[model samples]
Target: MRMTTNANRRVTDEQIERARSIDLVQFLQQYEPPGELKRIGQSWTLKSHDSMRISADGRWNWFSQNKGGGDAIGFLQAVHGMSFQDAVRTLAGEDFKTIPTTQAEHKAKPPERAAFALPPKNNGNRRVFAYLHRSRGIAAEIINHCIKNDLLYEDAQHHNAVFVGKDENHNARYAFLRGTLTASHFRQEATGSDKSYGFFLRGSGKTLFVCEAAIDALSIATLRKFDGLDWKKDNYLALGGVTASESKLPAALERTLNTFSFKRVVLCFDNDAAGQTAARRIFTMLRQQFSENLEVQTCVPKVKDFNDQLCVKLQNGKNSPSRGTRESTLSR
Candidate 1:
């Protein structure tokens, strides 16, 4: 077993907790992984990764993408000049030698996503994920990995959601606004906020995670790139917005049972007040739906949220090479 002396601990709950409270300082607490990288946000400009700012808000605001230099093996490998495997071992402590890297030791993964159900017309823009990757000045591997596994949302209701199909010019166009299905109205709610409805990524789900916003789900997808995780086999749905609505929560729980043969549901939400409240409510609904078969766990970012984190990480100074961070008049 790898044991660390009191002096070796890199992060502490108190520090992490403090970081979570302020959106400004959230990005700097990312040292959990030795291979961890940082990105800039839209709100921040002109700061380089090396000279990144930690605003009073506790966010790790970054510099321009051009300024955020690439590091080896993440910053860890760069500092240590080791191969990725050795860098991983460096982080693993003594477990480096004994821990099996065998394929057999790895968890048995679900089947790969063979059929990707692109919206007959979907119009969500994802250059944001890529923008975030570049702003943090993350490595090419990190950026490429995220782009490859981006998830498409298939289950959000109308008014708050729009579906897009292609125009004759091959440009993406909005197809229609969705209405509340019979399935939509049949759930529990706390504050009666229909704004927070449970969503499914792809209906025939097997493994699923739930969060509060489409942005949060996308953020999780962005984070998955760094963690060497995949979200396609593992699906994520957003509950629309941050309101204490339980109306759609139970509906999702039941579908998780009947429509999805899913074994797991991870509730990845913001690490703040609203998220905690919503997660608790959703948990109660889930327990009643499956009793034992459904397993519920919560995922929280040490900072603001998946999107908030990414948004901050990908701000490469005032502007990137192309669709860079929008130059705000307030920034000037």
Candidate 2:
């Protein structure tokens, strides 16, 4: 065993700093075993791997597994399954005397992304309409409004409900599918989907409302409508869902903040523990990243989620027990 001393401390600190500073993208190119890697803009997608998407900033997200991230050190542990000590030593450039070089140095070029495609449209929005309106308790007018705007539809094959996400040019960039059958809870992102442009509903006003699911976002709007609130004045965005290891805020949130000059952010996440944790984490990240003057607040539902609250309200009618007043427009 080696003895611990003050001189050893200086060497250990130097190793940590060097490991942390390694460029993740470059590190992958150098040390990663031969495999299929696809470049998506500045990020790289390991096609053969499990949703390993690495951004230029050294942050990574395993989208398929919903786990991710850290500096170059963590990347090694994740991608190569290295231990902390080995990963650190590798990044500190102390090892690799016997490791084979995988590839010659070459600059990567981003691949041209294919246009987003919606799953085949249903004969009519029949299944989706019934599911959202009758089962989900969303108003007919609200359903019709989304249908008319090309934001929601039913898939032709399985009759799943499709929620669309569009870029600034109004070109569809992502599609989220939800099952409509009773007792079904199937959900997935369509092929070629981009999370940066998640399902968004723009309103006439500047305040923004963010939620975890598309249905929850719509439920909040419906609730606003029921109260005769001007739901159309404020924008809404669904983050798709909360993942345990999502490192930063959703790409959708960042995009919306930059796209619109919104003054207030109301986080309407589900009322459960995971939702509460995500809301708090996102709130902290947004606060640090954006202007200090920007207002940020949480508006969790009284029930499991906004949809549940809306359903209860519909069931209770005017005789429903009084829920506490909410400062956000989503308050019942």
Q: Give the TM-scores of the predictions, in the order they appear.
A: 0.38, 0.66
Q: Give the Cα-based TM-score of candidate 2 against the true structure.
A: 0.66
Q: In TM-score terms, which candidate is top? A: 2
lDDT of 2 by residue, 286-330 (tens): 787775757888897878889988888788773122442333546
Indicate which candidate wins on lDDT: 2
Task: Give the per-residue lDDT of model 1 (tens digit) for 118-137.
Answer: 23323442333333334333
